[model samples]
Target: MNEIGGWRLSKKLGSGGNGIVRLAQKGEQKGAMKILRYDSPKARNRFHDEVMSMRLCADIPGVLPVLESQVDPDEPGQKWFVMGLVKLLTDQLSDRSGLRTVVQAFAAYAETLAAMHQLKVSHRDIKPDNLFFYDGGWAVGDFGLATFQGKKAVTGGGRKIGPIYYLAPEMLNDPGNADERCADVFSLAKSLWVIATGQHYPLPGSYDLDHSAFRIGSYLSGERGVIELDRLIASATAFEPSRRPSMKLVGEELRAWLAPNVEISMPTNIDFKEHIAAIEQWQHSRARAAKSQKVRDEAIRSLTNRLSDYLNSPLSNLKNLIEKSLGITTTINKNPKCGFLELRVEVPADQDRLAFIILILDLNCESFPAVNLQGRIILEWRNKAGFINLIWKRCYEFIENGADEPIKIDTLRAEMTEATLKALSETLSLIIPSHKIEHKPKLVRIKVHDEKGDMLSGVSLRFIDSEGITLAAAKTANGIVEVALPTLKNVVIFVAHGSFNSTVVTLPDENLLVVLNGDPRSRSMICGGSWVSLAGLKGELAFVHDEIEGGIHRLYVHLKELSGNSGAPGAVDLSIGKPVRLKDNAGRVAYMTPRAVIGDNYLIDFEHAGDL
Candidate 1:
């Protein structure tokens, strides 16, 4: 079609069963437009349903806004709807190890679902594909299956409609009689399971009508990775509908489950077999080239001179290859109990290039693990390329090479350690630092003290500038000391004691006071859990988002501990205009106030709710 209504069709981005989504621009309005297939009545009806559904959810935080829509005049039987486009969040369940993105996205989705349920709406088709990640929250689509309380559904003669993977057992069997709310809950939990495991579904077959719940649960529960999520979803997808929890309860449980655990390893699609083959091929080509090449004395001298330049640079030895090899070695028969070890050696800064051997003696005889020697050694080096690059080298060879004698532990250990240390140091010297921009600091002040209220004496503090410069010096001031910090944007401050290190942040105009009040060994708080202990805070508090876990939520907390309001957590419903008092832990009334929007989210601001 050349044009629809007044807008010109740009290009097709994606398509579905009902319509093809196209990027469209009309006058000053720009958005993604979905056009229904002209021949299918079902598709047009589905498009209308989605338009109305998203329009109703526009007020919700995560749902996207439906800008406009109308029937296509050029093409009879076709309808078109325009809405804001959002970035698609693909299958990344494995990559999200720390659960930061997943948790934040899920929280917004949960809030949107809760808001929908409260408005007497049911999103029947709840699947990962239907969930569109947007700025504020997820935008749910495909509402052809949506059904209101007194209205007839568009599917199965107002019967049952939902993705088979997420459909509740009761919904499939009872259809009209089953509560749509519970079905949404089951779907949400099932969706979370997919996000956790990166699996296509609970089991491997087409939508089999005669599926057994026990079989499905057994399969899902036994899946590898994200064991916690697997078990939670397994429980939610129980055959007995009565056994399943409510959607709100499921959301709460999921939130709690994700709080403590952080996943580290994510799934990678890199082909290891192909990579190995390429490495082997490269080695063959390089060996052949080296054997056939005619080298001149000048070329040799140039290479040696470059190596000399690297050795004489003022960077870490670990970053240089030549300097690192000269200083460190890998030892086999070494002190096993040593938490850390250091060796001092001399290196000739004028050497052209020297190859150092590093040997790793694996104590655990069960398996041979590849040692990551990337940053283990440092060398001093300088480069003119405006950045530092690590001069790194490693070789995989048998401990005894081709020797026919069994190696002694002590001898092999000494040799390996010697070689490894030297090689690492040389590598360090070759490294080139990344490009950076340095800014002059303004000024900030930081304070620190010990539990006895005594000033901690002789503490070592390191200041990191925004341009990646780090300066460290011992605290000359006794227990009480003040450090004048340059006012640099996005700089970090690190504080360290005996074996423990803490990061305290310095914000412009905000005074930084750290008072160590409890036993260092205690993980649990000595006071109530009103505030997270300030000791373990690692510069994370400086940039807290509005929707973080510790945000101002309308929960049943003892407001009496706060000061003005003294009442049970559940005594009054905490809302926008609700009058409530807070009491501190010592039974003193805290500030009484109505809620207000602080940033993007709403929180209770302190004031007398009304005239005292």
Candidate 2:
């Protein structure tokens, strides 16, 4: 026996390139001491990393602990650390050892690795020989290549670091930049395959299924498995590092292997009726999950187009409406800013991209998410989000967090249209001393009428200042809406109808006659699918689009002369995505631009679609 630090070293346990492990005993305590055999800088750094890493994981039940060590790796003579003596995990899952035992053991090992990962440590050199069973729990030992995430790499880049067979492809290909935690997950899973099959090691780049070992028990999967565990493992072992699950998720998945969705014993214990009810509930839950998954898949598929829909619809309307109604000439720079779908509205006022309204919707929302991607359809719309009081609303149409799922890009053009217009209006107002009307307010009567000189009822009117903010709003019942204002300079009034909103510049002293072009009773607040009388056309023209009746995707439209200018109602059909253009028999036109959320999930219906 050789004595050092009052501990007597006995039998040699193992030997590595730079160190040797020996059984050590100090009175009643027994441990394994690893002594450095070289004085190179690499060896010294390796020891330092090992000691520091072991110190961090000392309290975790599954990780091996260092009792005492030469903390300073540069110390003279032998650098050694003593750890609890445990048996190597090699051959623990021998052919005779049931797959049950292999599953139970590896599942716990997964938990241990998870604990290490939670601490941001990756035992980069994990292998069956590095794992040991002691104190009725498994402990992973050896931190020569262990990595502290986000820290400077101790070893040089571009070289394979771990054992060849258990090495993650990324570690083999790009060791320096490879995500250490994900690499560890790969190595651990590969090690599981090796042990479960009782093979010396797995064939590099080969799948577990390709090899044999009653590996089906290891194929364990469900909620975490869905055969889900199997899928998770598949993903964890995916060639791409990004595809792998985090250690925490892998650990949860491993534990889930032991849980049954419905215990087999439940039917035996519960009464017949209860058993039947349980089966029905279970079946319903599964069906619901499948249905939800289908909906989610369809929505995700629409994400790219939804992004385009935004640009073509609300954002397009915003630019046009601002120029026509608010008198602010603007342009939309449709290019992505920062790899994100950015809708930046610039006004001619500055002749530069002043960002009059910037809505940077995440093109890849999970990468560039929308409304926080879940429960609420939130808008972090440039600093102007707060100006429109009612612009923000819940995205119940997309995200449903009964349980939880990753947020998907499922927003529609119709869903965001009204909000976008209101926000644009409010935001544009901030730039308005353009109306330069400097006068005190006095009593004035604003008479509302359609383009035909017919008195228009139910027209909502707003009195705005030179600064472009609404000072007051009044709805008309007798064709006249009265408000007090000054008559010295010109006044700007906003006329609002359900589907039509216009900005009018007038003098407060004279009783102003405001002409609204579109119908006041539009079904949609954002557009006029409602009736409209064109300059040359006598009958009010529009279309009534029916909801989809079977699996049909085309829009079903019925053109009618509601006031009896009289031909029969013209029934026409249009495709789902293209803009709708309906021509009455008299050569009169009723054009409707669709605002439906069209995608893989559904081709939208026209109950409340389009503008005149």
Candidate 3:
């Protein structure tokens, strides 16, 4: 242990070329003390400047507050200062916290930098090591290399400051004439990049000032996710200082990106308590409610536009696959009514028959409790052939607890939109029937190909005449199907094998080739699709399709044991969409229906039936 002035230094925290930081204690209070190692006039002057800068910006939101400053009275040369002990941002990262935490930390850091710039102070060393977490927010520490606006460089000439990897190109090229503010901006952007994607800036060891911008742009263009953030970083790191925005502007932009609800300004001094109170007051106010409602409405509108764009874009590969694999053109009709978004999907089955699926997405915020919004997605579709209706309803909750500032209600809206799309895709998969046909007799030669244009063999083909009678059924051995003509007229063809299915009508002489794309194995199976048998259970288990009371089809399961030696009665457990455990008292499991059904089912085979 060492003693500096009246403070007892119990442990060393860190050390650098200029100073060493130690965990210090004064009686029962704990803090951190940084002591200068060198005793020269220049070192004393720089230390005194840091002390003054910390004192000036102590009240700023993100700047670390100084606790005590002391000079050696006996030596008349040694100097040291104490600051509030804080957890380093690196430590927070080592905990493997979520990306949302990282984003909030960076947002607070940017706010602090903006506040410092407003007071003409530049934190020359703005890196991860200099950032700390104090009182549930991030604060900037280590002011050893800080500079004030309009001040001359303390290091005489041609000496660069800050970490090498984060130093702006201008600083590296012309150290003697570098702008401290511009370098601070560039370093801040680099810090943000590191926080967002657990990686350092890609452009390192490339000091060519003229081509640095191109390298940065090219690197960012290849990156995915967080699209808006990438654009901001590219603009902030422009090679020319004049092209980069001010720190205040950068902070504002970052706040918007992180959470649109948070509004921060460069006040002379920020009071955390007052700021929190303001947020709480705004959260319950009529104005805030209106704003939140507006955000939800905007999110709904944006979702509609995105869906439309997806339907029309060339990259709508899912749409193309669905159309080509099902042999049906689907159309979406958007209907907005009473704070609910309704989308109706129309699929034509034949000249006289059609199917409709309706999806109702309710995003009303006022219907839920205060400080939270409940989003409900109701999916219902009716198949004309069986007059069967399948309905699924899922609800999601979005919370806005006033402390969730910088995280907007619009984010909740986006989440709701994503959930609705996923549910719609799942419902469509279950309702779409396998291939069926009704057409006049004809003679035709047809070929089939996979999405890659490769010929597909082992495809099963079924042809039906206009009188709803199967004319021919065969499996292609070499991706080709030929049939003799009853007449050169229209014929309905159903092509299927495994999970693939398609229905089409064509003349006998037309050159026909069908292309299959989507993997039907990925689609969820509905109730009446197929039944499967399982072996090696306590009894013989099988899944059968059954129509329930409300015109809903479901998978019914039954188990029976025959010619088995009498053993102690037990229970057989089975899980499909839900869990079911049947007693073996009667040597059989009665027929039962599950709560919900989705996806494929599998059964394991074992040597002994009781092994299950």
Candidate 4:
């Protein structure tokens, strides 16, 4: 072992951007020392800056501290600084770890980052390797890419200086000019998602392709408050910096989950922290975009894997609670290889065989995300035994409140319990003495296609009566779905995909093509008879922003009637950037807000503000 500054260097730990890290022991004390590689003045000064930055955060709980350092450049062969040794967080937890462990790590990471942001220091390069679990808490390490207030920028052109997987888009595009604090927020949020989910990288936006059964929220949902972590993560990792929440707010929300009522119990005896150490060598960069296809390959695990420990999971607790409270034993079957969370429950029977109920929740892969998580709450069972089965289910979505919110356990349980009771009550009311009659069911296979004649899958289609009473509903798979139609009464078929306008058709149109060719909206406006028409229609309609007098309120869209749509003559002014509603003499009937603009128009998008 070679001695440097009275410390004997032991095993090589890893390499960092600035230098090589090694385990150094001096008089029974061990720590990590990063030795500067290049001897240039710029390199020495940069290393000195790193040392000073750590020193600034010396006493912070979750920050790795700089202890002894050889800062004098004139008398040193190589610059080096010793930091207190810490075990990597990745070494403690892994792909199959419990969420409680992640929350434990997150609370520390959040608190530390909040403090750093307060001091104007940003740990821009955040990833699994740089995070450490030590001193009874988690700490963020490696400030190689950190930038503090008044720090001189020396970014090379066309070179990105942050961790490749976690770096914000803004940093990758313009690293020198990007906001450090905002970059820290994105990277930290990404890092947390990676730690919670043992995935290589986070998916874009809130569209998590992970199985609902194994997601972080799924692990903690049962009887717990809404963590809304998916939404939170999405907001922080938004492409725009203005959309990200402040680090302080992030810390507050994370710390809120640590409260007593919301504490999620550890479901297993396997403590992730006690696992064997697998120290990985850190890399400076890789491709910016992660291979999301690889994630698809590692999709849902078999249900047999859940035959044992899954009973201890939070979701299992919820299932047991529902069954016990209802005095009903739910008969459920699962195929381990399938990605759907389909459950069918048999309810209590009525006197004289007059009633029955079935509770079902269908979470298939195709119809997911667009509608998020959808399930029915109530249905009337039509059995020939004159037995009225009341299904306690209506169209309720667990994620309607927030697109990214997972099925929170408390919410799911409450809805289910209410649905079961309501369904029972409905069944009793509809019960009557009648003869038993059973007939073969009917299913009409209808294929759906888009305007261009391409097959459209996952579109939710509803079969209805003339009175707008829904008879049956189903989603199209492989561009086709079989829906049962009524034999006696006349019915119509319609498809409503999420919130978009549906492709409506009556019976006999089995091959449905989604032809949104003509502007039906325009036709509807014309047929309304009473509406607002443009004053003095001209050659070109230009919808642009109005920056006059501080924009005269944000919702103001300045409309101009130009001589030509492209090459502009003097713009003939129509309206200023102000909210305007066109009255049809039917009070509070119509309003206009720019949805999207065509051509090279300076469009201003706004919500309800100052009304005119």
Candidate 5:
């Protein structure tokens, strides 16, 4: 057994040219103890700088946190430091966790590295062993060769620091002129390559070791793995530092790959149970006083035909007016209870497509009694290069008649036609040359999953603008959907699969992973089957039945969080069912059952089925 300072070394972790690491223990706390091997001034200074760098990034979530440091009192020159001990990446790989876990771990690692770069420090060594699973997530360690931006080099020129397999070409060819941050990016990309493909390095004859160009495109272009991860690694490992994306961009890309769901909370003043009860009462009253089925069917058919004729005839004139004025071509299509118009505008000189205008008008007679008219107008445009772009969009709701006044379809149609023309004219004026715009199209990747973390294929994702206009829609291919929009404007994403309560997500600028509740095997099964109001709680608890595994039906209990000065609920003692628990990346307790108590274990009994 070896001992350094007050830490007792149990086993040798690893050794390198600069120092040796050992599993160290002090009282009950365990950590990694690194002992410097060289007594030279350069080596001593490098060790001191490493400690300083760690201290600088101590607050960052995923960067390894330093515990203690000291100079060997007896030797007067030797130095050592202790850091939080964590499981090796090899341990995770050995356990054979899913590919999603691997991607999530690397994504956290990238975010931590990017945070360090934001502080102007670069970790020159980013390889597999240096990354460890700490607090249930990945963290970066080993800053021995770390460099600070705008600071003089600590080591002499011509001495490359990282291993050859992971070294950036510039580090070998022109060490003096190489950008330390870019070199770190290159090394991280290589690390990701290893994680993605389980290979030591790029394929043996992929590219010359001396050449700066990286020829791992073939590996990156593979059909397996996440597409966004492939693109990010490719860009990070570009031949030139200028060509590589910034660490911030790398962090964003990684986060997009691990895409978490967009969180939605009920409004503060809304009581879900009370709202549902009110709606039920109103429905009962309406059902008691409704007309005969035959009479209702006849009325519905008449209204449908009237709406179809109005859109075909009156709306056509409005479409022609827009085309003649804007010098574009238009198409009209009928929707279930609405009408859709698409107008395409082209540049006169080049004949290249310039813009697209879409309009959706609600034609349901049922809604006319409450709100006379509702519609939306959207404008999408692209540069000379044909890409999807959005220039302007707006939703309109107008009441042409109050309870005292009867509704008139002709009057409503004429008024909407004028409003449509005005909106189109205003939109075209704001369409500037694409080259002059500063913001690029934002890429949004959506992955749909079930409660058990299994990906759902063929799910439909619809992108709706702020004004409730459907901009674009796509079905998931292999549980993933990727779309590019011209702007990072606020939008809502509506996800639908056979009858799983359609989930609505307010789209963020970043990518997303949407977890929905329905089981495809049973189309009639309602998500969160039914809500049971808790005795002393402000909100209800509902159980969503998941798949049956190992002869046990797994159910997720969702607890809606309380609002305002509502007191916290008591420990929910469910004697009827067994409770399940989950963990987050940091090993902190997280509840799969929404709004449940954190850090507390659960016990549930389901002996008496169908009884709350």
Candidate 6:
């Protein structure tokens, strides 16, 4: 039996610690598929979480969609997920200076992180590889390592589970007690540093060092580039959890730095890292696109063979003999053998010459099951003498029951040759009238000439209109029509001729939508994370980074709002010129002297700083 689903697997794309990816397709839909190594509890749980988180963030432009997710009932330990295929940036971190591109790629990620934090959630792990781009936008992916703040992780056992290179100093010192949200900020900062510098953070073995020691040594040593970012990383990755800024603040700070220097022409919507990781995540989606293309190619080849056979047939000349004596033009129209069989013959100005014909062949063609043996078409024209005749024979089989063997090479070559002969013979039977035929104006025109090749005039067209309403429409002398639209937004046009329809759509603005007309498998984008604090403020500026069993952490104070003049309960318009430190979620302290000028409009409300 033939395969019910139209697909053929192509090749393997990639594999990783969790699963292997392959290219695949269903009908015309091409994408990638990921099959897990085993559906262990950990795998299944992670898979479930990934699907859920991806679905929640589906509106984010760069993130690929999860087409389907299935678990093997029998194996119980086998699972699979389908994802959109994307092109990947090859090892950009170790190679080129793509900081501008990197920022563009992670713009969407920043928005996502900010939104997530607003909802009181923490990704827990943020790194370069977990970001991806799709349709020119960025998204944060790999929620497998994510831990929602204020609550115990969905999966128990507090191991230092994130990538070591992006780990915060606090997580390195004591993994178990490290605050999830604060640690996420440090990791995000580390990622930014890598993208900006194309190198790892200052401390190479920081993940293995004591948190307290690494923080003091790395920050004071000044190994990382750009003094400002180095200091920001140091404060965000401080050994003490209380010293780290919130993810929201980190996003703000990163935006502040990038906004003034907007030299990046990239879309602020896509993530490129996620695209790379997705290639590492799912390979099946790629296979699907290949399979769909193969089917279409095969079908087209079959039609071409049939046409060639009719054109080369020896009996083709008989069609011309009948049309000349009748003093009329004959045109034969028939459906190809692919779908359904239809034959229509039109003779201008002669009722007897017109024919609506259908032909059926009883012979069993064993190879082509898609062809219908019971249906075929033939059109013939004859004069009063009836001795000399014009005949056109065309075959279209809509239903065929035959052997399911692959078509033989010899048979195809022979049939194709015969089809070519028949097509030529039939074309000669049609006689053009003295008047030329025009189909439309300023679009597509169907023209005709007489036996002497003299162009005919006063010929009108019968075709479909813009609304698909068929009518006797005429063309201008230039053979064109002005078909305007209701509005500029409706820039797309679709033309349908009988059974087939061709559509043309105008490209929308970049922010609106992107059409994937070609293979999406070879396309991809980079991914990155967002910062919480723009100016590196931590400790007292806390607004419930996450909920813990006992209480909240990443605490800070709003010094500007607290009235220090008379030691009374009052509020002050928080400013950013002087450095401020939030201490123990209980009070605020001066980190820098009043003489240190940062900027104005920096709201460090002593009472309302932790409003988040």
Top TM-score: which candidate number? Answer: 2
**Model 3 residue 4 distance off true place after TM-score fit, in angstroms:** 1.7
Give a tens-digit lDDT track for model 6, residues 1-612.
Answer: 121124334678777667767787777876677676655666666656655665565665444688776643334434777777655432432344344455445445656776665544457668877766545556566565654433322544455557788876656546655556667777776676566554444354322222332322232222211333434555455555655555544544445444543346775866554344234223323322343556546654565456435433322343354356554343333444322222233343133432222221222332222232322233222211111111222223221111111122234334533543453334333322333433323333333233344443332222322222333334323323333222222122222111111112222111221121111111111101211221223321211121223221111223333323334332222211212333332443323211100011011112212222
TM-score of each: 0.37, 0.46, 0.40, 0.43, 0.41, 0.37
User: Clashing pairs in model 3?
Assistant: 259-406, 439-465, 439-466
lDDT of 1 by residue, 93-166 (tens): 34534444664556566667777876667887888887876654456655656765433225653445688887
Can you tell me which runs of candidate 6 are displaced by over 4 Å?
Answer: 1-9, 60-64, 71-78, 88-98, 149-158, 172-177, 200-202, 205-225, 261-612
- Tens digit of per-residue lDDT, candidate 3, span 1-612: 388768999878998767889999999988999898888777776777777788879889878888899643235846899988999887867545754576678778878888886676878888878889987778999888888643322765666677787878877656556667778888877777676566655355322222323222223322222434444565567777755656765665556555534456865675564344234333333322353666656644654454334333321443455567655554433445422344444554444444444444444333221122223333322222222222333343322222221243445445545654565454444344243333445456888887778787877665544333456666676788777656543244555544342323322344578765433221111122343332222444455434346434444444454222232323233322222434343343222223222222221211211112
**Candidate 6 deviation (Cα RMSD):** 32.2
RMSD of each: 23.2, 22.0, 23.8, 22.7, 29.4, 32.2
What C-alpha lDDT values do all the predictions have?
0.44, 0.54, 0.54, 0.52, 0.55, 0.40
TM-score for candidate 6, please give it: 0.37
Per-residue lDDT, model 4, residue 244, is 70
- Model 2 regions more than 4 Å off: 91-97, 149-153, 206-229, 264-612
Misplaced by over 4 Å in model 5 are: 71-77, 149-153, 204-225, 260-612
Candidate 4 lDDT by residue in tens digits, 316-426: 554576578766555444432221333344444343221234444434322211122223332222222111111232233222123222324345555765665565554
Q: Better model by TM-score, 4 or 5? A: 4
lDDT per residue (tens digit) for residues 1-612 in model 2: 397778899999998866888999999999999888888777777777787888887877788888888747556766788988887775344556654566567777778878877676788897888888887877788887888743333777777888787888888867766777888888887777666545666656634322223233333221122232333444457676755656665565556555545646553564454244334334434533443556545555565555455445656776677678757555555445322344444433222213244444433233111113311111111111111111233232111121112212334445455555655655444333346645555677788776778886777665654333446668888678888765434234545554443433333445677776543223222212455443333355443433233322233444555222233556554422222444444554444433221111111112111122
In candidate 1, stretches whose alpha carbon ends up further than 4 angstroms from where it belongs are 27-29, 39-44, 71-77, 91-100, 149-153, 157-160, 204-228, 258-612
Residue-level lDDT of model 5, residues 134-163, one tens digit each, is 877788988887877433226677787776
Q: Top lDDT: which candidate number?
A: 5
Q: How does candidate 6 score on lDDT? A: 0.40
